[model samples]
Target: MKNKFLLLTWLLAVPLLWGGCDKPLFKTDEASIAQPDELPPITTTGEGTFACKINGVNWQRCGGGFLQSSIIGEWHPVYKIFSLQGLRSCEGFDDAVYINAFIDSIGLYPLEAGQYDDFNLECQDVLDQYFLLETADNWVEILNLNTDEFIVSGTFQCTLVHEGCGDTLFITDGRFDYDWAN
Candidate 1:
């Protein structure tokens, strides 16, 4: 009888210990945004940089470019077209942040500074993939967009949802300035 009781207790405790040892789906390091003095000088040589806070942690990318997608269809006043991607892929994973937006058209829509636009922002790491949660509320402000030079700059903030991990990551103070052609 004593042996049986000991075995039963060991079995229950083993399962509990194993379950308690499970790790979190995602983990982020604590980091702060870079100040103006810390930022690299803006380059005119056509290289672009993207920087943002991921879950309050700082992340930046030095490789990416801007382009426009072909017109898919017409939406009357404004053509229904997608701004081609300017993406920065995260190291060690098939994840990236689609950073900039460029509305390409003849004279239908003028690229205006300080205009807030909804963007399909995405971020993924090894563990999970995240996308913009509130499409309408989450927006990026165009700081500058020069059609002739093909240079664009912007700032953004959004909440990203990871369905697989059942978690959310808030990205804030996002900024990108890139000269598309080099």
Candidate 2:
């Protein structure tokens, strides 16, 4: 009778032990920078001397950054195209999607511990809300995964409901290119 009780206790404890622990994390592998010879063709459309402005003031250049990624297996230029919907100048935006341009200031954030895959980028809006965009999604399809430049050509709109300002929509369209700064 004692043996039966002990066996029952052990069986219950075994499951609890297994279920309580989180999954073990794995390290991501590293990818090398693509050689100039193997580098993918860069899109010449909208290239050279591009600029942007926010609230009628000149802002930073749209593209000119680089990121290193093991997944991409090369030093990829952080370039992509994005489209915006429902945006207007001097209007309070509430519910709209906008195509916001972005540049990869830093290399991709690691999906694993200490792994830097150039597939991730830190993007922000005119308001400076940080959006950590990743290339693992459909972005890989829009931008040539083999080249440092990829294009994200789609309509994105944002609908914002500001309590004080009511609501507004913002949208834009453009291409982004990236270069290594540091």
Candidates in order have lDDT scores of 0.46, 0.26
Number of the predicted model whose lDDT against the real structure is largest: 1
Poorly placed runs, candidate 1 (over 4 Å): 1-47, 62-94, 99-128
Worst 10 residues of 2 by lDDT: 112-121
Model 1, residue 66: distance off in Å is 13
List model 1 lDDT by residue over 1-182, tens digit each.
99999999999998787677555334331222232334344333334655566666655543333222111111121442323233433232222454323354322232211111123223334434455675524655656556567665556666766665566767677665666544
Candidate achieving the largest TM-score: 1
> Which digits, one per residue and each the tens of the lDDT, describe model 2 over residues 1-182?
99999999999998788776674233222123211222122343322222222212222222223221101111334453222222211111111122233423322222210111111222323443322233322121123222334322121112222222332212112222322121
RMSD, model 2, all Cα superposed? 18.2
**Model 1 clash tally?**
0
Could you report the Cα RMSD, in angstroms, for every candidate shown?
9.7, 18.2
> What ranges in model 2 sit over 4 Å off?
1-141, 145-161, 180-182
Positional deviation of 97 in candidate 1, in angstroms? 0.8
- RMSD (CA, angstroms), candidate 1: 9.7
